[model samples]
Target: MKNLLESPPDKLLTALRDILAAKSIVSPAEIAERIALTDAASPAQGARMVARAWTDPDYRALMLHDGAKAAEAAGIPMRGMPPLGVLADTPDLHHLVVCTLCSCYPRAVLGYPPFWFKSAAYRARAVRDPRGLLAEWGTVLPSHMKLTVVDSTADYRWMVLPLRPAGTEGFTEAQLAALVREGDMIGVTLPIASA
Candidate 1:
């Protein structure tokens, strides 16, 4: 018998899908559709949500209160995924997210996790010395600001709502979204206002 652990992920997924299909648990087409949906997802979805939250107090309240609903409201499907939690960065507080065991990310909003986000070094540094990690990413926060590191788990994932950049008061939502990036939503970097 082949060792399942050594099997490629695509092969494993195919085998699992075959088994589920055989059992009538879920059809192959359904699985393919779901995969397509996930593939279509990107950081832009999260950026849109962040921009909306920055410009709309009601949306911001909903995002902070229920991230999954916020994602759905932003038109990103959150069905059959772990719960999402949005951590809002404030002038005095910042949030850093990491999955200590694995790369448990908000894929429904942020698409695939970045390669660095799955690295052991990032996971260790994020929990051990988040400030240092941020510095390495060129995200230097104020010395007086408190940094909180949150763990994203299989049961619950996390995404950051970074503070809106200065000089963006009059920017349109699309413009604000343009300033946000995957790193910003992951809390490794902050959005910078374009001069």
Candidate 2:
């Protein structure tokens, strides 16, 4: 029972571990040491890209033209990592992403995807019927924006830099985070405001 409680899904884990130090399977220090976070380069590139896209129309245009090159222009060095690319959500086409084999994500841009994103249901259903999944995520898209699901592999990762939402003219970066839904970044939602 002690070991079973420590398994994930057991809320008692935190309580027991806190009250009984000896019962703790993993120390805070050990957990911290085991965890691996992205380097500064990752978020730095994402921040730079977001700022450029916000302020520079030409840069956004350049990004839409070519993702990899846009990253280079945005001062992101990508040669060391597997090919980093960007996906622009357009009015005519919506892009959703998945890694069928494993979680191949653009950590440099989007950071870590949610736990659900790396789930088997998401990976399987994303490719099976993307539109249905988007609708389930509260995104109702028009027939115009055709949905395209892209699979990220071990050699490559994917990120969805969704289209800027309407009514957000001149909004600051902090404000934009609110408009940018997790589903939108996951490619399961479009940039449509709630009714």
Candidate 3:
């Protein structure tokens, strides 16, 4: 038999699937459905939610109160996923998210965690020197603002609702979404008015 550990990921997954099937632990159809769901997710889904929240007061309140519901309302699937928490940024405060233990992220909304988000250096620096880390990402905030580092875990994941940029008051939801990036939602960067 080929060594499973040395096999390519595709072969390894096939082998595991065969074993699980033999044991009747899970069905192939279920696995395929999950893979399809994951593949369908992308950062655009999160951007849509952010854009809606930016333009609608009711949506903003709903998002701050229950993030998972807000995401579902925005057309992102939340079933079989952990609860999502949104940290709203304001003039006086900023929020940064990190999974100190592992990369427990809101994949259903944001698609996937960035490589840097899973690095040991990032995890350490995020908690140790958040200001410096943000500065490195060109997200330097004012000295008077409060910066809070929120940890995402298996039980819950966190996303940021960045403050809307000025001079975008007349922008449509789609236009506003165009201005949002994954980094902005991750709190590593801010969304600019000029997309």
For every model shown, what is its TM-score relative to the native structure? 0.90, 0.66, 0.91
- What are the per-model numbers of colliding residue pairs? 0, 0, 0
lDDT per residue as tens, model 3, 1-195: 876677899977888999998899988988998999899888888999999999999999999999999999987878999888999999999999999999988898999888999999999999999999999999899999999999875698899999999999889999999999999999999999986
Every candidate's lDDT: 0.92, 0.68, 0.92
Model 1, residue 155: distance off in Å is: 1.6
Give per-residue CA lDDT, model 2, range 46-137, as digits (tens).
54565567567888777766666777786665555566666777778888889988888776556666788889998898899777877888
lDDT of 1 by residue, 63-141 (tens): 9999999999988898898898899999999999999899998999999999999999999999998988899999998
- For model 3, the superposed segments whose C-alpha errors exceed 4 Å read 1-3, 6-12, 19-24
Regions of candidate 1 where Cα sits further than 4 Å from its true position: 1-19
Model 2: lowest-lDDT 10 consecutive positions: 34-43
lDDT of 3: 0.92
For every candidate structure, what is the RMSD over all alpha carbons to the true structure, in angstroms? 2.4, 7.7, 1.9
Determine the backbone clash count of candidate 3. Answer: 0
